[model samples]
Target: MKILTIQQIIKNIENEVVFEAYAEDESFKIKIDEYIPYVCAAIHDGGQMRDDVLEKCSLSTYERWYEEDPHTAEFVGNFPILIQGCDSRFEYDLNRDPDNAIYEEAWGKNVWETPLSESQKQRSLAKHHAFYEVVEALIQKLESKFKKCVVYDIHSYNWKRWDRPVPVFNIGAELVDHQKFGDYVESWRDGLSLIELGDIHNYTAVNDVFYGRGYLLGFITNKFKDTLVLATEVSKIYCDELTGESFPEVINQIKEGFKTAILNHAFEFIKNETSYKVSKQVNILHNELESDLIKIDKQLYSLVKDFELLSVINPINLEFEKKKFLASNYKYEPQFKYNPLNIDPFEFKRKLSNIKVEKINDISIQNMYVDTINAYFDKVDLLANLGTNKFLYNSLRYFGEPSKKDVDNANFVLYCPEFRMEKEGEFNENEVVELFKNATQDYGFQFDIEVSDHIASKALVINSKKKVVIKKGVKFDKRFTKGLIEHEIGVHMVTTMNALKQPLKIFSIGLPVNTLTQEGLAILSEYYSDSINHDRLRELGLRVLAVNMLTSGKSFNETFLTLMEEYKMAPENAFYLTTRVYRGGGFTKDALYLKGLKTILNYIDQGKKLDNLLIGKTSVEYVDTIDELVDRKMINSPQYFTKIFKKHLEKPEINPILQYIFNGIKD
Candidate 1:
């Protein structure tokens, strides 16, 4: 590549000093060849117009009058690039962020002159914005080929006109770490020490001296986070402060200082390390970490991917950011109980995992017995075909006396008894009706009490012919409402009715190992009702992480230790929760909550009704699998749930508003 020396760059600047159109010349062509220098643009005095003296002037007097002046226009056009200082005099200011009060610059007081013309706005943008773009393109080109660029930001200020005490050398401070580009500034400062006839303190560097509009620094930092920007606010001491006239000797000394700083820093950054080397090293580390992390993620996914297989589905797409990956419409989770081989020793490098993994403890089984019984009952209820079975009806008479219409051959309920009392104390029977009321209300059920001294509570059946079974003395708490509403009315009852409505008896025989869909629907119901609070959601989140941890070679004890000891979760909840996710692999249920949330949102996005969802209808099957079912005519409505759900293929276009509400809602 051709290289231009500092003298050549300076000579070209001198030639262009007259601001006339460039002539075709060898020196100009040579100077412009193969490189672009960086320019730090700073706008000064941006605060004054909004707060004080400049506010007395109208917008027209400041913006138009200031730019139209031939001297000011010539000064701007002269520089290869111009950095703006926070100047409140021209427009309320460009240095302050647009979010700042000064952005609209309303306070420039004179209302009549405030409205600016289109031409003036164009002129301002051309002078200010165009400077940055030209410099940026040059820098990018240089960095692309030679792997580095240099920026020299220049400004002039009054020697003693500050609100605060002045420093000798004001090296515009913010967060400039001069050491980043191999300490180029040190050489310039060292070189200046030999030439200075003044005291050492006269060469100090202080920040925020003449802070300009935030744009110059903001734009440059955004593109090259590691690129160096050196802004020097030169004191007007070398000139006649009142008249802006120069003292040749003093100006030369200052110019030498500026030139030295620029040349030294540029040479070091370009020669010390090529941009390609730095970027290459960064890219390699990123790729290696990404590859390792993805392998671990897929391993974790394998454990739960099968959990949804029963529903015959897979995720349409999975997205990964930093370290977390999200998959929607997942079906199955692999079993990872008591397995010690899946854990990755190097996985500790990522912290997002901390939010989702845990270990088991003794109290993990505190709710196990009840859950097991419920599971057993679930199995029994399915075996007897409770929806259409007379035997099941006879066993649940504790609900009350069942009317004849309560049971039909197809298991349809023509009518159900209304037993809820209007007032708590109105009932003559002095039983714990409050508890019974609370428990039944959760399932959208209410029943009348019938008394018999000889009744054995455990064996008693209520409303037998109606197929209503109420367990007597059932205590109530928040869980009762949740369990009944979510499991009974939401899943069991709905599925039963759906079966009765179907011409096929197999639909009522219970869904086949459809745990994922069943749990997904139950959770969705809880979410929609606002019953799934943050704590409940956290538990679900923990399960997700636990499944991932377990499937990736973590042992039960290791997971328990990490979750309860390291993460400090309640031991019991952590243990049992971890087990729930890994139950199939001893780790599968973990993906249900996230997958459930995604499925419910997908359903709504298609503009489908929540009522249809209540009818035990869900979209969980894989796209390919669903297609197979559709082709075989095993499923209908290919245009409804299936079509909308299939739209997940273009998930990137999903509306953010709908997504936020759907995910935020609680069950």
Candidate 2:
């Protein structure tokens, strides 16, 4: 427990003696003895939040510790190389990517009063990078010294939170090539399962609650071929979780038991036949390619966003650019390098045709990632191109649009005029915000409600800092209250907040091609809550029809008349729906509302899980990609869900007869 710098720790490890050193502010600590071939790490064991960050957090200290794996380092204290984090994961999760190490929400409670500014996030990310720099140096030294090494990446989990009984031990092998290290992983689990202290039945299993798909394990596996790192989580059977107290006997039993188990696995690893070591150059190339794709994604999203800004700056200029750009075949300067996969030319063309899904080694996962990201990039490009052109954008969006036949098969449409809710009474914007606040409060999400004059379209929208913004003159239509709650808070904001907790900035900022899925899922939430109304369904249908008109070269005025004269919508509602379709000189994304609704209904008809829809700012189409990342342990299932769904489902009388019936408004 010596207070020292990373430089000092790296320098002293060669001494072949037990010593410990603390990296900056004592937030992360490491110890080494002689030149051991194995290291132990407790990357998520910390519960300390910086004073600056703590002042802004909504969570109590007890809540943070409950999620943090306590006493992870102590289990392997005797190991020669031991590294563990001391700062609370709420401050920065060492196991996540540095890009999204800081969280906007943790377990659904707003983790910060406001999202940290660039400087504040930079401080935390800088610290994260420093910790990894030391790790890179440490592993490099070990592999150089031992020619091959093993690392026991230690962690813990709360078994009580799980609905079903899980084994006492979980081994994550999602990232590791099992064919190469499967024997060692299995042997470790078998040895630990048999550990006996006072109670003798501590069970162990592999790939239970956690798969060794954490960033630390992934980074080590990718960077160092000779090093086999094991990501392990022990259920909180060794302590009092509510109080973060360890039972002395249980702790000692684990320390002694895992010590034996780890050493045995290490020895076995050294002599294991059929090494699956990949070249260092390949590792470097994969990392570089991944970074480049992310960089391009960031550039594309950041530069192309702000539809409001574009429309406001100079509508005249925008119109001019739109017309001029259309004359040039509606092509604007490319936002990023056009090599969608960011791979070499030949491989890039090949990937477009051959989409493979496998995870045999780093290579297989790398190929899968390439394909996934490329698909996302195309979606993103479509989204970006939407507002820039009416004719061209409509042409592409029309492909995703549901035809009349597909619309006929819509499973749920709020079409019964008999239950018109306008006479039921409406609430003002303040009351609507109050309802939102009450729902979020029940779920432990803390955020502020403010009247905003700056927003363009949202009657209300949740900002990045978790603040709910209401437009100045917005009123809550009685018909829309329940639907808006489930759509925005349950789907949109839930995904936004959950994405902040993930390691990928793409999830927090925006997912590749996620708009359709997000909107579709929001519609699902509205349907599930039984808040769907004829007016809302008609509005959605008109948006699709409006976009169709645009694709067919109809002017904005013509689309507006179709909704008002043909659909008989009121002037105001027609204005909002039509304007949404024509906002950015003929934006076509509104088509997704109708298209996505059909997609989700089809998804439900096929008996697919809906909870995964809440996993970050994700699309239902990218469900497989999300699954791979989860199986790889890159992300977790959404921590917060609309509990209202459970409550709504409990009503036996509310049997929804599956049929979409929309009585067309008379001309």
Which candidate has the highest TM-score of all? 2
Off by over 4 Å in 1: 1-114, 117-123, 163-165, 177-201, 208-213, 275-667
Clashing residue pairs, backbone N/CA/C < 3 A, model 2: 16-34, 48-88, 172-211, 172-212
Residue by residue across 1-667, what tens digits does model 1's lDDT show?
2333434434444444212121121111111311233433434422222233244345544343222111111112112343333333254334333333123343343433345555544544443443344445545655565555555545555654567756445555354554564365545334434334243235545464654224555566568755566555555556565454556455444444443444345445555655434321112111111222234333333332222121111111111210121122111222221212232222421322332211111011111212222333433332233223342232232112112221120011101122221322222222334444453454444344333322111112222111223333433235324433444344534544443443222223323233445556655555544444334445555555665565466765567667676656765455445544333223243445455555556655676544333333333432322232233333332121222222333343433432343444323
Find the number of clashing residue pairs for candidate 2: 4
lDDT of 2 by residue, 1-667 (tens): 4687667766665444456678857889886644556678998888887788788788888888888988787777555567889898888889888776888877777888767778877878877887888888888877886687778888998888889889888889888867867777788788788777675467788888887878899889999877778889988988888787778667667776775576566656554432324332111111212333345444433432321221231122323433443355423421111112222434433543343322111222333344445654444444444345633553354335445653443323424443444555778878887888997787677677776544434444444556676655666676578888788787777877777666555565455446677888887677766677666776676677777786677775676667778878775565556555565455566677766766776776687867767767676656765665565454677787756555655752332432334222100
Best by lDDT: 2
Please identify model 2 stretches exceeding 4 Å from their true place: 1-418, 453-465, 648-667
Error of 2 at 43 (Å): 35
Error of 2 at 442 (Å): 2.2
